[model samples]
Target chain A: MNPFKTIFGTSAVAAAALVAFGLTAAAPSAQAAEKTSFKLAWSIYVGWMPWGWAADNGIVDKWADKYGIDIEVVQFNDYIESINQYTAGAFDGVTATQMDTLGIPSVGGVDSTALLIGDFSNGNDALILKDGDSVEDVLGRDVHLVELSVSHYLLARALATLGKSERDVTVVNTSDADMIAAYQTDDVTAVVTWNPLVAEILSMPNATKVFDSSDIPGEIIDLTVVNSETLADNPAFGKALAGTWYETMGIMMSDTEAGRAARAAMGKASGTDLAGYDMQIASTKMFFDPAEAAAFGASEDLKTTMESVRTFLFDHGLLGDGAPSADVVGIEFADGTVMGDESNVNLRFTTRYMDMAADGAL
Target chain B: MTRLVNRHPDRPTRLLLAMLPFALLIAAYAIGSDMRLAENPNDKLLPSFTALGDAITRMAFTPDKRTGDYLLWVDTVASLTRIAGGVAIATVFGLLVGVSVGLLPYARATLGGFLSAVAMIPPLAILPILFILFGLGELSKFVLVFAGIGPFIARDIAMRVAELPTEQIVKAQTLGASTWQICTRVVLPQMWPRLMDSVRLSLGAAWLFLIAAEAVASQDGLGYRIFLVRRYLAMDVILPYVAWITLLAFSFDWLLRVLQARLFPWFAPEGASR
Candidate 1:
């Protein structure tokens, strides 16, 4: 026997594969029946904080119980990995950005529904140069960023405004965890990243924020997207999650001490102090009111955002294997209008749940 | 009722036994993959071997759109070069310190404990410090691999030399051999094969540090590729890269074993006595 295999008993390799496969074999038909329990995955971000806080504070439980279902909110360390896990069917729902919602999961062929638009990154994502007076100084230089992330998207947009393409500069793929330390080096003069790393980097001497996501508002949006199949089978899961979210959103956006405490707890949970978390929250254009979220969900602006996102993702080759055109994946908006290839609609932006919340129907 | 058999297994039997575990592992993986794909055809984790094979062909055969370079081959060459450079530097430095410490009692007394202490200091713990001092360029990764195995090599050599028969030294001295002559002629020759063996043992550790350093920060390497695709749950790409690393490590070990056997005909491999 191989000593490594003997020692580890396959180390959950065989078991994990079997379990995942077994679940998949039964998932489609099994999900058609009622599901009493479901898992939702979230990551550490200012806009996504309410999910964790709501889960911890029993707010998710309260809302879930109201619908006679159990909702478990799980946290992921890496943002993109959480969406990947959702795409893998490990989670029923996940928190994602507009780009990732269209790019990673949709491109991966997992049908998803945008249940909630929590916030838009106004000045949240930025480009910082150590010594450059303008973003154009990045020409012929290597810009460090987490490649394929919103940071990469922001960098591409920033370069476009200057009439420069990705060919103008080299992209050095760096992790968000190491970006700050990398920026301190003389070798790395320019970096494109998102908060709270963006906030921390800009605090450094001579670090200039030459570009931000605020330039194109409503383009970089954070969303709560659930598996369309799961939502179709268990509508209560959507109602439960939306109800819990807006309830927590109300507390988070309020000026009362209860609200402040909730925000502080969320900040601590995300490994940042209240002040730091508050700074990130400020840069986030949060849609606290369900009426506003419902309106945003049903707006023409979302279609435009999706169009731009598809173009950016397609141009970057992030739209998956052999993606012949930008219309490879169809996006169904809230008003039943489908954009792109209608037969292959993978992304659905539903306003019914949000409109219900706005009407206090939940 | 039973036929008489040879006490030792023949070459075919030995080879069969050697391959059985790997064959079983492959079977287990295939069955697991089949089950997963049956459930969800788009399952990324625990990808079928066919998926892995497809990913390998894509990465190795096709050029990336942006760079127009075959990334797998580029990554392999980059990783191999870094490890080779780091290991070569380590071998020279390790041999010099190990031999000096072993030959001279004063040198051993002063530096022996210090080298032991250095070996105990986990190289990974000081990775951030190395990055801070050396910058995030190739130097940091090189230093990581060098620091990871150099001390262990030195300590092992020191121990091997200390355990050598004292009579050899006395015989050389009785022949009116100078201290330098005794050290250079008697010690260095015998220590060479052992050094090669030590290097074979350190290759595993050297790869560990190299990959960790690369995974944390690098433009191009096998570790970088694995981590970069990890966000997408591209296990098809990752598992193949892991196998490739294992193959490389195994090949290096086999080469060293052959070199040791060819150069030192009298050296007994472990379990040969039984």
Candidate 2:
């Protein structure tokens, strides 16, 4: 064969192959219809473990299949990072606390809705005093806790119980990883922290649980928050999530062998044994019954709880720099009462899916 | 010295060359940030200059509403104090150990291999153990930076000692110099410059360990501030903090270079160039 002919033919073949490869690579987006698949991010917490358990136990799959959609469950080692991922649109939804959802996503400009009220911290978070029987003993001492966290909120509320404020004691910003270590130090006599850490610290002989989240119930609420635009586009996603959550809740609430097994699995996943997990669960007021959760969501008490949370967040400057007041991010409740700026509603608490779960409509 | 592309630029040209990359980086970031903001004004990953400027003013200039601390200055002072204290301890101990390891056969036999092994252990991996052992005070953070950086400095000094010409030691000995005389006059004098060079090389790692320790368990630090704001996707604050850290690191490296040049004008380590 002539050299020119062979060279030209080979080059032409290579170009065609490249074009074909390009077309194959570009085909997926060209045929992209409405997204049927979604990702849900969850982190390790006593309140959020059900989302993981549901995914692992095929509960997530069953519901997703029923709705003719695919749901992928992702676990983040960090609680805040999970919400950040959801805010960044890397995930469609996430397990988050009410204040966190409002402070981060709502104020940061991601319109989100609390899809399910997973649980509220009952005694999961606590303020403990070393060698002191009363919360008053923490007076004039530097209180160690993760600053601007729910522990800080608990401390503020705990202090309020004593008819005092943060001014009574200096709040030293210790990290969660170092909380136990800080407590072990002689100088560190008081600390405000959450469960697992609470469990560990309370195990020490002199440590007394002076106050906890239970003292202010429904204030530290955990929720499965979903992107509002995504939910509006795919109501099936909402139904599927509600189904998955309530189903998991039923089994988890039961004292049957299977329920115990699921609980044990969840405990193991969260780096604890059965008894250890149960202790944490004892501190968490899990909304096992959808009707109760829905009623709580619709109640006027929720608006009051949110008001306290928003005020706490705003006072701490956890809200974005642009926030002129606590009302920078609007939080609409099930009764249509907005807690913040009504013109810019971002975090909405709707009981629709919870109601459907209660009525067995999903 | 034997490599390809050996053409050297003058000092002003070198300075201009160094500035080019930074200028290009800033331009590229501005463009990307503008494009993202044009699409969505609420985008956080690359915030606009105005947002960053506002964040800087709030963090650096204004007193915090609750605490009344200038956030940036406090964080910087905290971080710098820890790093300076840690590195200072590292330097003194490093000089003593490195000289011994380099000059004494016993020190070489005892500590040379052990130090090499210690340096091999990843500092960040044992951070929890450090916190637990040191009890989460400033001591733990200091010890972490020391543990991370100490062994490497010692090893470098030891090697520099070994590299000392035998003739110089013998010459001093021939002149009836004592064992201490060779170390004080010949060995240590040479090692001082090398010690500075070794420290210059390790400052990057020193910063890494310092930042990691701070990130893990600090009340206030540059790294702590960066990590704390990360939860909110506060890129405006985070980016400025990062740039400030970079500036601090570069200043330290530059200061060491100036110090070395001023103190040892007659000396130049191998591979020293523009």
Q: Candidate 2, residue A193: CA error in Å?
A: 1.3
Clashes of each: 4, 1
Against the reference, the lDDT scores of all candidates come to 0.85, 0.84
Per-residue lDDT of model 1, residues A240-342, tens digit only: 9989999999998899999889989989988897788888889999999999988998999989888978888888766655679999889999999999989
Give the lDDT of residue A311 in candidate 1: 88
List TM-score per model, in order: 0.91, 0.90
The DockQ-derived docking category for candidate 2 is acceptable
lDDT of 1 by residue, B1-274 (tens): 2323424446886677577667656766677667666765666666777778888888899898778999899999999999998899889888889988988999999999999999999987766577678888888888999999999999988888887899999999999999899889888889988999899999999999988888767789998998888766777889999999999999999888887888876775562421
Candidate 1, number of clashes: 4
| DockQ per candidate, 2 decimals | 0.38, 0.23
lDDT of each residue in A218-336, candidate 2, tens digit only: 89999999888888888999999999999999998899999999999999999998899999989999999999999999998988888888888888777776679998888898988
Residue B192 Cα positional deviation in candidate 1, in Å, after optimal superposition: 2.0
